[model samples]
Target chain A: MNSKTAIKFSVLLLLFVLSCALSLLFGGSETMHLSDITSQDFIFWQIRFPKTITAIIAGSALAAAGLILQIIFRNPLAGPYVLGISSGASLMVALSILAGNSFHVFSDFFIGKSFIVVSAISGSFLVTLLILLISKKVNSNVILLLIGLMFSQICGAIQTALEYFSDPNSLKSFVIWGMGSLANTTNKDLLLFVPLAVLCLASLLFFIKPINALLLGQNYAQNIGINFKQSRFYLILISSVLTGLTTAFCGPIAFVGIAVPILSRMIFKTSKQQIHLLSTVLLGSTILLFADALCNSLLLQVSLPINMITTFIGAPLVIYLMFKNKHW
Target chain B: MKGEAMISIKNARLGYKKSGAEISVLKNIGLDFYAGDVIGIVGLNGVGKSTLLKTLCGLLPPLDGEVRIEGELMTQIALSELAKKVAIVLTEKIGGFNLTTFDVVAAGQMPYTNSFNRLEKKHKEIIKAAIEVCGLKEHQFKLINELSDGLFQKTIIAKALAQQTPILLLDEPSAFLDYASKHDLFLLLKKLAIKENKCVLVSSHDLDLLLKYCSKLLVIEEKLAHLISVDEAKTDAAFLRIGGGFI
Candidate 1:
């Protein structure tokens, strides 16, 4: 690592710390001033703490997923949302809601209860499997990306059909979940998400050599002794799990999955997977916290949906990057 | 010491199958490459020169027969293990054009690094030495995208050198280079094979450069392959028929 990279990493770390501090202090009827220790403090500790922790976990997971996907596909635009993994999870959640199921029940009995969590996990994995199968058949990267987009549209059509058949109460619940929120998550949810995310991220870090070699191209990577199939499978598996977990917890948080990695590359001026992963993690958390803070500060009557804020901030960045240069 | 074969292929048959149709590119080909030998492969555009290079380096599996590295089957060896024995420099431009020259060369150390992806002291020393040998120390910190095509070619060659593999395969290393750059590249390859004791195999369209610099030539004609000593290649009727007139 060079001094510039070290300095940039340190700055991102500092910003992450500040974001965590700010998130802890503010949110959902819990204002903790330095002067008073009241029920509000307890509320902040209990309610806001879990939510903030969930956001951090989700942000890191999604960003890492995006980074991995981009490297694997060799396309800058590849991500959980664009590749239909989010839609897969969303369609599962929508199905569960229509069946009058609770999300927490799925989290609890994910291992055994042949119902909600199992269905969601299988749905996500199935989409990833289809993608892998298609990638093997169709060697063109652009065609793979288009296939993913078509899958996303197909999932959206199913979701709409389900909504059409559901009653008002179930529809309302599904709509709220679709809007994406990090709030109301319990410690058990954290137990389910954090470990999986960490494991996936660790595996991703382990495959950095192959991913870097891929920057040169597949033939070159293989020539350098990187097993092309093994590395590609590992990366896809890790990315699917990361994206699946985040979409399970927070409903399809739009654009953060696609945007954070791009932003990190721009700011850090490097596309090395290691640097991209680290910078994406820190920048992802900061973006989420900052957007959540904005949502709270602006909407006095109602808590604005988290996805709306993320989309608002993220879309502009995507547009700017798209138009900036062809080389990147 | 003078004629020990570093790479040996026995009855190698390489090709691809599609729709139950097998197209044979190389049939029953066999050759031995020794250290300090600069070998050149020349053929028309579609004649499997690149495929042969890839197969010899163990990037592609042979349809039949085996490639042996020091008497070990290439397929039986682990990828990282195989990587330590042979390195290839391709003609494709690297995707991360924003990387510095040093970073691009350091990427060669990937097979050598441990879990944290940190290079060992020995790995770093090798990378530095490769940079110096490639004459790229002045451009070490320069962004790869900003460099001339000649520098980019050298940077890739430097990466292959840093790999420290005994056998090096280059696919059209001089394809996009200017006259001066091509001259410099051939000079560098000759020195690398002669002084550094590397068995180098390069594919090129410049027959003149290949004839002057390489000790042996592998000519692919009409989908058949032949390996001939460069001196005999001059008077051989088969070589004369294929060599034609232009470089």
Candidate 2:
């Protein structure tokens, strides 16, 4: 790494740490003080600490997943959101948590009662498998993206049907989940969330070389001894796991995937995947932490949806990227 | 040719497998490429020039006959081992932006890298040597997306050279270069084949330049590939046999 990029990485990493600290310090109400927490460390561990960790994991996983798909598909606009993987995850959540005996699979129909993460993974995996099969048939990248949009629409309809049949409390929970929050995970849920997120992120790390090779083009990547099909399979596996698990634990937080990598590349001024990966991780974590801070600060009495904060920040950036289409 | 055969294609039928049936493009081809030969494939448009190149590089499987590379069957060779023996540059446009020319060339060192793709000092040296040989020293730090057509083309060639493969396959490699750059590319390929003792296969539409610089000429006509010497290609009936006078 050059001195300048190294300096940039250090600065971004520092900002990430600061974001983590800030996310842990406060939430919708007063600052989470050690002195104020007299009842067995009440709000800090229950709310802020796990939420901060959730922000870090969700942000980095989604961003890295987005970056990998973008490189592999050679489309700057591709992401888990646009590709329907997130919606598939969201659909599983809806079916498990909100459906409530409307469409029982068997005696144990509520996927949420046991292994919600696994159910979400199966949903995301199925969608990913369908997309992969479709991509093989489609010749154009644009058409592939359109098919992804189709998946998103179909999943959206199914989730809506489940919501329509749901009871009030279940509907309320579904609404809150759709709004996207990092504070949904209890300490009990973290037992399930952390290990899976770490595994997905590690898989993303292993793809650094193939991702870099993919930037040259698929045929070139294969020529350089990268098994293009296999790498793509792994990419789908990793990305689906990340998107699925994050959506399971922390709701479908959108736009961090598309926006963070774009900003990282624009700021770093390089397409090198290794540099971009590092930049995306740090920047992604920082952005989510910043958004969480914003969510806490803006309402003060009530926590706004994280999706609102991220989209308010991300959509404009994507629109700006669209105008600067040449770089994209 | 003093060296052993680098690649042997025996009665190979090449085609695309589309929709459960094979759409054959070329059939019954027998060819051997030596270590020190620059073989140029010349054909009209849509005449399987790129297909033949793809089949040779194992990107496409032959429909019937087997291809052996360095005495191993091409299909049976491991991907990493095949990478060490053969390299290819396609005409496809690359996507990533702001990649330095140095980065593009260093990608050739991929097979030699550790699991994390970190290059060793020796691998870095090979990449540097390739950049130097391709005359990209001044432009080495420039982003490939910002490079001129000629410089971009050089970056692709330099990448192939850094691969250290014995056989190089280029599909319409000179298609985008200007006349001067085209000649420079051909001369470099010629030098690499003769001095470096690498087998080079090139497919191009520049028959005149190709015939002059290449040691041999390959013509694809009527689903058959014919390999002939440049002197044999220089004969009076050669252009007529290609289906018309030169355009």
Candidate 3:
């Protein structure tokens, strides 16, 4: 690594550690003192620990997913939500909560517990599968992106229709989820998310060579012994799992997936997949923790949504990248 | 040609099918490509020159018939095994990458690396040789995206050379190059084919340059394919009729 990369990595590492500490220190009704351990510490431990870990997991997962999708598609705009994946999961969650219909409605036999997470994951996977099928048939990248946007719009329409008929109480709950929050998840949810995120990250590590090959373009990657279809399938599978998990625990936090990887690339000054992947994970966690802090500290009566903060930061970065670099 | 045929395609059919319409590009093409031969393929745009190269390199499956290497069908061979036998340079421009010119060339060794993407000592040696051969030693540490188009093209060629495969394929390698860069690339390709005993096939719009440099020629015309020795290609009645129009 060059000096520039080294400095960026160190700064990110420091931010990650500081954010973890800050997340543990401040939040909930009462803040805990650092010097003394008390019953309030247990409340802070129970409420804040899982919430903070969930944010970290969500951040790392989304950022890594976005990086992989962008590199594979060779489009900086490609992300977990860009291809209708988050919309699919969100729509499924909306249907389950707003319509009061159980997942068993889709299948004759189903277990009731963990149904929300399962349904969300399956919904995202189904949409990812559809995108993959379309990609195989269509050779144009712009057309694929347009199709993905259309899919997102269709899912949004369905979500809106469901919300229109929902009872007010269920609608309130669904709306809160839609705003995106890390506070609602429990330790059990963290147990579910942490391992899944780590496993997906591990699988992505195995794909470094293929991702590097992809930077040369698809035909060149294919010529270099990568089975394009198989590699793409694996990439989509991992990205979907990561996206699905984050959406399940924290709702669809927008733009973190898209923005973090691009930010990491600018900071590191390299497009190599390995460096981008690592930086994305760390940078994502740092941004999410900071956003969560701002959401907690600045809001008086109503806490600002995580999605709102991410969109605020992400939109300008997108504009800057587009205007400054024509080739990216 | 001192050894057995390295690549053989028999009774191949090339075409595109869209919305229930089938368009045949090339039909029943049979050919044997040998080591130490620099073959030039000349054809009009959309004449299936790229499709033929893709099929030979196993990028596309032949609609009909078979491609064989060392007496085995191409489809049955693993992708990694196929990569060891051939390498290709494409016409598309690459995006921004902070890779040194040497790192760009070292990517050719990906097929031989273990699953972790680590390069062995021998791989490093091959990469060094590739960089030296391309005359890019001074620019080895320069970022790939910063190089001019001519140097970038040379870097891609150096990457292919690093693969050290028995056969190499290039699609319009000199399409965007200056006259001097184009001349130097073709000369280097000819030298590599003869001195290293590798089979090289290239598609080109520069018919005059192809005629002067290539040992053999494959011409695609009217949905048919013809392979002829360069000497015979010069005197054939068909050649005189087409003349400079082939360019």
Best by TM-score: 2
Of 1 and 3, the candidate ahead on TM-score is 3
**lDDT (tens digit, per residue) of candidate 3 on A128-224:** 8888778778877678879988998999899888878887877787788888998888876666778878999988888988988888777778777
Best by lDDT: 2
Q: Output DockQ, candidate 1.
A: 0.54
Error of 3 at A225 (Å): 1.0
- Candidate 2 deviant stretches above 4 angstroms: A34-39, A98-114, A133-147, B1-3, B236-239
Q: Report the number of clashing residue pairs per model.
A: 0, 0, 0
Model 3 over residues B96-164: C-alpha lDDT tens digits?
A: 545667777888888998876777899899999999988899998887778888788888999998888
Q: Model 2: which residue pairs collide?
A: none
lDDT of 2 by residue, A22-95 (tens): 78777547787656555567677687778888888889888988887778677787788778888898898787
Q: Rate the local accuracy (lDDT) of all candidates.
A: 0.79, 0.83, 0.81
Chain A vs native chain A, TM-score per candidate? 0.88, 0.90, 0.90
For model 3, report DockQ: 0.62
TM-score per candidate, chains pooled: 0.91, 0.94, 0.92
Off by over 4 Å in 1: A34-42, A96-118, A132-146, B1-4, B17-22
lDDT of 2 by residue, B42-88 (tens): 87788898888888778998999989998789999888778888899
